[model samples]
Target: MMLYYIYDGTFEGLLTAIYDAYYERENPELIVAMDNFTDNFLIQRRYIDTDEKKATKVHNGIINKISEDALTNIMYAYLSEHENAGKYILEYLRFGFKVGRLVDSYLSDDRVHNIHKLARKVSRERHLLLGIIRFRLLSNNIYYAPIDTQYNTACLLGDHFAARMADQIFVIHDVKRNYGVFYDKSKWFISDIDTKGNLDLHEKELFYQELWKKYFESTTIKDRLNPKLQSHFMPKRYWKYLVEMK
Candidate 1:
């Protein structure tokens, strides 16, 4: 019989389910988010609550027993939010606990391979967004940048921007996910924003954007233009957010 551990669609919740699976000694066929779980009487499903203590125990256990990098890999995989991401992380951690730090090195195994791929995918998007994100000055004197990303990467961008633009008030909004990271001069945090109306940009921001677009146009030589090569470096999916591209 296939038993599914259904969690509250949170990382901690998923970890708590893993903790239950470990202590209860029940092998769940799949650990699914509540939103993903279907209503079916034939399926044996257990709803796991987000328990901080149990989740922390599993979190610390992974760090102390396995490698710190293993924990990071798990975080990235979870942030990937792929349908099978939770399942992959559970299997990856199970293997990591048994073999210690060398868990990721055994990528030849499918359990190890899938988690690593998801982590890499999220990391790659984070890296690209760091370069591609364009911030505009707003009427409230805040720097606002909106992005539409495939993965949940808005939260991952805080530390990088917080350090780079230390003195500025900025918000990196993931419009697709409808959440963003707010960075003050001192720290950064994530929250939702009101995106119902048009953005009120500073008068100078429009001038700056136009200037940037003109500069790009002036520098371009039609004879030497290679859009394919340009898009190779800067993916077409992100062009919609770029001032010059617009």
Candidate 2:
């Protein structure tokens, strides 16, 4: 019987779950953010929460067993949040287990190639959001931005904005994920914020939104419009946060 391990959707939590699974004699399948069994065939499943110590241990172990690049690739794949991330990780780990120390050379393998490709895509999206995200100044001197992302990228983008906008109070909402980053001009924190309640635009903010929408519509060339190309560059999922579209 294959065992199942569930984690709390953090990289550290996943590592701790991996540490738990490693002690077992039988290899098991690991999953995150799932509570139900697919087949109802009496599968043994265990849930693990984030543990910094256990995660550090597992991370250190992986570094000792494989190269740093392997660990980075695995972390990138984990961040992708793609449907097949767990299976992709399993394939990567299997390759690592067989090759022991030379698995990095398997970058050409289809499984490894896909993981790297997903990582690059997610990275690019996060980078674009960092430079392109616009914040509206609220009445209380707080800047706010709302976003909907296909990946869990709020934490990553938070670091970038916090450093650049260090002198101002700001919050960035990942509307799709129901979480956001709040920076009070000194420190930053992440929390679950309901966009419906917090994002009621004030008159000034509304005016800016209107002006941005007009600018966006005005900038488009009728003869040069390519819906497919535009969609590929700026996916529909993120349009909710784009000031130009709003």
Candidate 1 to truth, TM: 0.93
- Candidate 1, 95-127: lDDT as tens digits: 889999889799799989998899999999999
lDDT of 2 by residue, 137-157 (tens): 777767888777777777787
Question: What C-alpha lDDT does candidate 1 achieve relative to the native structure?
Answer: 0.90
Model 1, residue 68: displacement in angstroms? 0.9
Which candidate achieves the best TM-score against the true structure? 1
- Which candidate tops lDDT? 1
Using all chains and alpha carbons, the TM-scores for the candidates as numbered come to 0.93, 0.81
